[model samples]
Structure formats: structure tokens, C-alpha cells
Target chain A: MFPFRVPGAAPIRPHGRAADEVGRLRRPFAVVVYLQSRDPAHVKAVERRTMDKPTHLIEFETMLLGRHLQLSAPRLRRNNQSLDRSAYTLLSRIRMEGPMSIGQLSEAFGLDASTLNRQTAAMLRAGLVERIPDPEGGIARKFRITEEGGRGLDAERSANISGLEKVMAAWEPEEVAAFAAYLKRLNTDIENLDGRPWPRP
Target chain B: MFPFRVPGAAPIRPHGRAADEVGRLRRPFAVVVYLQSRDPAHVKAVERRTMDKPTHLIEFETMLLGRHLQLSAPRLRRNNQSLDRSAYTLLSRIRMEGPMSIGQLSEAFGLDASTLNRQTAAMLRAGLVERIPDPEGGIARKFRITEEGGRGLDAERSANISGLEKVMAAWEPEEVAAFAAYLKRLNTDIENLDGRPWPRP
Candidate 1:
């Protein structure tokens, strides 16, 4: 679905969970479609439409992930770098799926083998992850989250929750709950679109 | 607040009015409390905690502004590149106060004149805004929204609405109304934080 390929990046694998969520959302399931005649203008149009419509924004953010770094900006400025979705996806997977092989990571993210190599290279340089020889095979490699990565993830999670807390400081509990429910659904839809199974239906 | 910057092009600005609308939904109010701590990690930690909450994701997107391709990954691609929140602040001013002078933009965004010059230079190069020689004071330049800038704003608005629509596709009219009301209040709170006068309040 992505037009340009990041040489060393992997596509995030959706699995059945995401698929199920998307299915529930698109009940009678219309075939997924894209605008065929695409140019900078068309892409811009799509972006405009996505931003204007809340539903569209949710879908686009969940799928394309527009603002993953909003919470982490200040901290990231030390290095003057922000983690994009590709790397974030890897972090999320490692956090969610535990340790896995390079091949598995590649499949999960739909990234080419080489892309994973480059991404992993960066992650390794950052000490976010570590590589160990594969137990299954001598030549193959397996990656596991490092202590630093775990700490970073936890920090990110805490920051995320804290950020939410401040934003809703004046919000009623009911309002927060309603929005949370919507967020939950949005997350589910994103997972489904990524080919993961939905929680419901 | 980010652990690492995304290495690559800057985040894409929202394509049009839709993007502007989306930006509204993406955040709520935040108190810009100055930090006494000069430590980068400490500042980032505080910033992340204050901005990373799940509910605040929308707001974080705009504030962090990685989604618009203005600050996040785009700035980090090249080493030694620095990003200040001034341009984004200027964009916010334009959105809140409508068109004004570079001086006005500078004051509203809390930026120095030289900084605005540098920012406007980059902005003009990107074609997101235009330099219209100020009519009131011909000696000064008044930056105005270009057609491309308008389109970008529209794109953001559309993307935002699209996200909401996805969530609301199954909701009843009343549910939509309820959500809209809540959203309106939320927007008001955010505007208050930004010191902008709200129409309803």
C-alpha cells in the first residue's frame, strides 16, 4: 500500500487482530480502495480530507500514523531526532510480541530483509535493541529488547499517559471514557487494517 | 520528549483546511509552564509525561508537530540541524489571529525578528506560505497564506474529520451531537490555554 519503500524498513504485520477489527468496522466489508490518479495534488487532497474529517483522521493516523512523536519531542531533541513509525513499530512489536527472529520481525513489519538490517543497525546504535545468535540456526540472528529499550519504552508509555492526563485535566470522567472508547476502537481498526484479528466479531 | 528523532524528511504539513480542523481535534489546553531544569533528559521526561497521554495524542501531534512534517523526522534527517517551535507557533498564530505582519507573527510566536526571517525563508522555499509586502508598512513583509498553504490546511482538516467519521460511522445523530459538543468544549479549553478568544465563550 505504501508507494515508496524504505530500503531497510519493515512493514508492520497486522495479523488477524487488526483484520477482525477492520471487519467489524466495515461490516458488509467494502473492498479497500485507493485513489488511482495520484499526484502531489491528489495526495495533498487525500491529506486534506483526512485531516478535516475526524473519522478520516483516525483512520489515517491509525494506519499511516501521523503524529507518533508529539509526546516525545522535547526528550528527542537532545539528539535532535524523533522516532518515525517504522522504528516505533519495531519498538511496539518488540514490546508487544516479545523477542523474535530477524525473519519474523521482517514478516511482521512487511519490510524487506535489507530494510530490517538498516533499521536494526540504527536501533542497535541507539542501544534500543540487541542481537543474539539464533538458537534455531547458526547463521540466523534473533533480536531481543535491551534493558535500555525496555526503559525507553516504559518512559514513553509513562510520558504518553501523563500527556493524556494533562490534556484531560479539566475533562469529566465520562468525557474521557467516551474518548477512550473511541481511541480503543480506532486502535482496533488500525490493527485490523494492518491484517490483525479484531477483538470483537 | 522523544527518545530519538526520526531520521528522514520533515513531517508533512496538513494539506489544507481539513488539516487545520484536524489539528483542532488533536489537542486540548496546555499550560506552558517554564522549566527550571536545564538537563535535557529531565526536560524531556517532564515534557513527555505532560504530553504523551493517549487522550492527548491529538494535541501532542500539533504541539510536537511531527505529523505536519515540519519538525519531527524531517529536521532530524541531517545531523546538526536545529528546530525551534517558532514556525509552528507562527502557524498557530496565523490560524488563531488570521494574517498579520512578520513583526506581528514574531510577537505572537515569541520569536526574534532574525529567527522569523530564517523560518520564513524556509517556509517560502517549501511553498507553504508566501511573502506579501505589507501594505500598511511597505518597509515590512507580511506573510500571507498561499494557495498551497490553504491546500495543506485543508488536507489536515479533512484527515482529521475522516478520522472522526470512522468512529462516528456507526453512531446515531444524537451521539454525534454529544461528541461534537464535547469536542467544542475541549477546543474552547485548548483555545483558552493558547490565549485565543473563543467564539462561544
Candidate 2:
């Protein structure tokens, strides 16, 4: 997002090293950075070698990825990305699953009703979703996507893709597709375990 | 997470089809839910078919992944995972990079100094990290992970992996490794593009 550069930073080590070094570091290395400042200072970080399983690596990477995506929103916002995180998520959900009541949303997302209420309230204010009588004649009122929501979702999703494209600019198309497929599988599996499966497009 | 089941939810479709169907739907399908409650009510939703590239799919999946990770903290917390989100994140970063000043953390994370200060203050209060003099004689003081912080990060990370293991219990080991590798690659690419490359083992 930012074209930040440390004047004297070391090149990044290639991958496969960490993944390949699984079970290689029973007593993980303790990093001691030589934090410097001003005149071409490099915030040196040690290469962490963990005696962790591949799943551990996945967990750690996802944690960092979550942070990246959170920080990524403001960067994209300047590029005219309108949808906030919740809106993108809810709109995407509604797009995939059609109309949903608070109960169904709660069940699908594993989120409490109050949280969904707050999110949907904001979405309502934004005109992203409209209250509709449950099409199947259920007691709980359902939320259906308005044209604005769909349009906003489409735009925001497109912007996100554009941003990702830039991030993955150097990656092979096959690699990109494979990574995307893996992520989808990973999430679907998590959803399955949570009993809150997100509908796929 | 909740093992929530609607009395009548539809079966999941196998993957590969969506990834293969790129650019197939210019105007995505409009989902219609058959939301019913009580007596075997099915929250039936139509499948969405988007005219998007593979990059778009990645974007959508990653957004969902962010949600999964956020929601995952609570599930893991119940399993004796003690570190809160910020604590776990900060400790992990500290562990990986060793000690870091607020200025260094701000530069690496793209977060403001105020946010870093607040996070460090919380870490200090929680006994997770401590302020230490800059090793390289830099002006700004750095925060180092405490023994408690390291121990907590390890435990929390272990729990996270265990949770992921349960989530991916059915997948083969090779698949797990490939997913992890892809995830690392994706994050590194993001970090590289953002000019804040995370140090790997």
C-alpha cells in the first residue's frame, strides 16, 4: 500500500525454507534486532525458525494476513473503494445466499444477533439492504439486497481484486489460481467445522 | 464455534466448479432464500455464479478468511488460549523480530505511533512486553517480549493449530502443506508489495 523503503534493509529470504524447516527448530531462535534510527537505519528482524507443523504456519500467516487486510482497507479507500469490511462481507453473503433474516445471518456467520443487528442497521442506513417479508412466510423478517448493495458489492469486490492483482502481479496465473483455490478450500473447511458454511458463488 | 444446524439445510456442493467457471456469469445469479423456521424449515439459498476472474475469487475468499480468523479467537479462547488478539499479534511480531521501538513498529505495521503506543501500553499492563533500551543505541526505546508473552504466544498458536487441525481433519497432509505454503507465499507477496516484508525462518 505504501511505497515504504528502508535505505539499508536486507532482501527477503525466499519461502519453502520456513515450511521445509518444520521440526528443525525445537528450541526456536531468539531474535535480537539492532534497532537503529535516522541515518539509513534498518529495523533488522531475525528469521524465526519454529519447530511447528504446517498448520502452525498457516495459523500464523493468517493472523498476519488478517492484519494486512485490515490495514489494506484505508489504502484502497483512497482509490475509491466504498464498501467497509462489514458491508463487503454482508453484501457478499446476501449475494451468495439471497435474502436472510437476522437468525439465519447469525447462524450462517456464527455471529450473535446483536452484532448482526448493529451491522445490518448500518447497512440499512447505507441503503445496502432492505427489510423484506420473509419470502417463505417465516416469522423473522429477512434482509434482501437492494440494487445499491449489489452494485456496491460488485464495485468493492472488483476493487479488491484489482488490489490483489497488483499484490500478486509477479505471481504466475496458475499459482494465483492454485492459491485462490486453496484459500477457498481452507475457508470452506473452517465453515464446515463451524457449522456455518458460507455459500460459494 | 456453534454446531448449529437447521433442521433442513442443503448439502454442500463440491469445489472446482466455481474456479473453473470464471467469466461465465456477467450478471450474477440473484439468490432467493426459502427461509422457514420451526417445523423442518430450510434456509435455502440459491448458488451465485459470478463473472469474475480468479483474482476476484481470491479477494472474496480472503475477506471471508479475515472473518474466520477474527471469529476464531473466541473459539480458541475457550480452549485455554490466553492471549487476546492484540497481545498475540504483538507478541508474535516481537518474537519474530525481537525487540522493537514504537517508531519501528509503526513503520513495519503501517500503523500510527498513537496506535502503537496504546498497544504497547496495553502489553505493558498485561505483562506481555516491557520497554527496553535500544540495543543499537537508537534514541527510541524498544519493547521486548516478556517470558509470559512468549509462553502465551506459543500456547495460543498451538491452540490455533489444533483448531485448524480439527477444521481440516479430513484433508491429506500434502494438501495441508500446500495450503500453508500458498498462504505464506500470498502473505509474503503482500508484504513485499507493501514494502514491509515479514521475516521468515
Candidate 3:
């Protein structure tokens, strides 16, 4: 049986003649048949089909990620670097892409200008980013990552990756690769649907 | 070339004599060699090693997820249901696990009791949850999801799931499963490291 039921498929009859037959055959032949059918390719296909129909898992992932962020918010600061995870991320973005106008940042991050303004303001106060004339000669000023900000971002990134490495230490290398590929793909698709959050440098 | 560069490795000599050699190899042989070397198992291992060493991708995932949540937050309300994503998730927990005391909710969510208190108070004001006597004879009043809350939750869940489906429409079923599984594992590990939020029913 598949791990997840198909979304609108007929409900499995729990106590019918079919069920009785399944129960009776459960010990030997059924086990043999199940094992025989579960070759690597077959198992992969089945797992794929099971994941295709339901939105529950995706929704659950979103909820869990949100909660994880909330749970970790307080601990985001480290070693006198007062920037939170979002701030650190912003700094990293600027570092990677060079200076960007607030409007451009808002577009890339899918956030309101006001929210970005507040966040950037706080970052400015901390000297993590500074406004500079747009190199492209645009009217709007651009924000660039400061040297201090670069160090802070490096610290936070190292810490986060170290934490992930520990959590994933027991996983197979293949599993880690699949997970990373899938996550990257998911983000790519999301960016396609919305707007690209991180333009390649 | 791998999708991600290995951390601490020397940068790809993009403009060196080696670059000229690689460029001279041209399309067919170079493409064939690249494809052959990217066997599923080999690629998976490479990806795993890359992810293990770099915090950039992990940090990017975190930032993307956080931004996605913020982007989706304003759309959570519909009709007369005004619950935010966090509130909807909280109500769903109550619905799934039965009535829970504020203290229990706090512990489960890894949040301060005062935060839960304020959130629950808002839920009460919205009539999404109601105070009830704890069935287990606990002194603190427990919170139960109201019928209206259930309906609101259903609406919000459907909307969120629909959005995810659209965003993920182009993804392979295998990709979806891998992403979901990885996300779940990540959350479980995070919970273990910190404190479990949302006990199993």
C-alpha cells in the first residue's frame, strides 16, 4: 500500500470481504509479493506518486518552517552581532549583489517598501549597511554592505551551517544531496511564480 | 561542473589557461563527460558534501522561507475569518490535539507563556477559541478550538495548500516528496535541539 492515500480515491474498506482476504494473505504470500514489488525504482515511483496528490505535506512544511523561524528568532544574535537572521540575510544579499536601491531590494525580497525601510534603517543604525549613490546614476540611493556587516554575516552563516551539518550528520550523503536539490528547485519555482528573490551575481 | 561549488576549494579558474583548455573541448565531449560523471549516486554524494560545508545555501533557504511566510501573511484572512498564519496554526494544533492549557501550548510552541497568553486572548476576542476547564483536572483553564475556528482553519488551509500546489505545479512528484521529507526532518531535528513544539497527537 502507498504511504499516503490518493486525494479523492475510493476509501479503503476496512472490514469487508476484500479486507478479510487481505488479512488472511497478510503473513506469507502478501509479504512475498510486497517485497518482490518494492525494487528501488518501483519504490521510488511509488513514493513519488504518493507525494504528488496531496498538498498537506507542503502546507505542513510551510507551517513548520514558520514556527522554526519564530522559535529561533531570539537566539539569532551571537557574539555581540545584534542583527537578527533577516538582517544578516539582507547584508549577505547586498554583499553578493553589491549596492541595490531599497526599491530593488523590496522587489527581490517580496517585501513592502515600508518593511524594508524599517529593517534597513535599523541596519543603518547598527552600521551594517550604508547608503551610497547608485553606480548606475539612478536618483534613488542604494545600500551596500559594510565591512562590519560582512563579518557579521559570515559569523551568522557559519553558525547556521554548522547547526544544519550537525542535524544532518546521520543522513546519507545521497539523502542530503536530494534534499538540497529539491529545496533549491522549490525556491526556484517559487521565485518563478512570484519574483526572483536573489538574482544571480 | 557541480551545481554548487565546494566550500574552501580554490575558486574555479574561470580565466586561466585551464579555462582555454575547457573551452576548446567544446560541446559534445564536454557535455558527454559532464553528464556521465553526474550519475545519480555520484551527484548525490557531491551535493551532500557541498551542502555540508557551505552555510550560504542553508541561510538562503531560511531567508526564502521567512520571506515566503511574510508574503503569504496578508492573504491569510478571508470572508469573516481574520486569523493570521500563526493563529491558524495554533487553532489547528488545538483542533488536532484537543484542548490544551496555555502552559502546555507555550511549551509545545517553544514560546513564552506570556506570548501565548496574548495570542490566545486575541483568538478569544475573535471567537476562534474558548476557555474551557481542563479535562485532566489542571488548575489553568484550557483552550479549545471553536466550531467557527475549525471552519476558519479549513478555509485557511485550503487556500494555503492551493497556493502551494500552484507554486509546485512544475515540480516532479519525487521532488515534492524529497522536499517534504527533508523539511520534516529539519523541523524534527530543530525541535530536538531546542524544544518540541506541537506534541504528537
Best by DockQ: 2
* Candidate 3 chain B, run of 10 with poorest lDDT: B11-20
Model 3 CA deviation exceeding 4 Å by range: A1-52, A73-82, B1-56, B72-82, B195-197
Local accuracy of candidate 2 as per-residue lDDT tens digits, A1-201? 112323564323233334223223222221112111212223222233222335777887888888888775456334664777877888888888899999998887788999999999999999999999999999989999999998898888777878887777777655767888888888888777677777776
TM-score of model 2 relative to the true fold?
0.70
- Sorting all predicted structures by TM-score, with the top scorer first, yields 3, 2, 1
The runs of at least 3 residues in candidate 2 whose Cα sits more than 4 Å from the true structure, single-residue gaps closed, are A1-53, A73-80, B1-53, B76-82, B135-137
Query: TM-score of A-chain in each prediction?
Result: 0.55, 0.71, 0.68
Give the CAPRI class of candidate 1: incorrect
B44-140 per-residue lDDT for model 3 (tens digits): 4533333343334555676666766756434332443446867977997888899999888887787788889899999999989999999889899
Write candidate 2's Cα lDDT for B1-201 as tens digits. Answer: 112323564423223334223222222221112112212223122222222336877887899888887774556335754666767877888898999998888888888999889988988998889899999999989999999888778888878877887777777655767878888887887777778877776
Q: Write the per-residue lDDT of candidate 1 for residues B92-164, one digit (tens) a residue.
A: 3465555668787655544468877888888778676777777666677788767766665555444445434
Per-residue alpha-carbon lDDT of candidate 1 for residues A101-196, written as tens digits (9 for 90 to 100) = 778876665446898899888988999888888766657777788888877766655554554455457875446656555444444443444454
Query: Native-vs-model 3 lDDT?
Result: 0.66
Per-candidate TM equals: 0.48, 0.70, 0.70
Extract clashing residue pairs from model 2.
Answer: none
Task: Give fnat of each prediction, in order.
Answer: 0.09, 0.65, 0.44
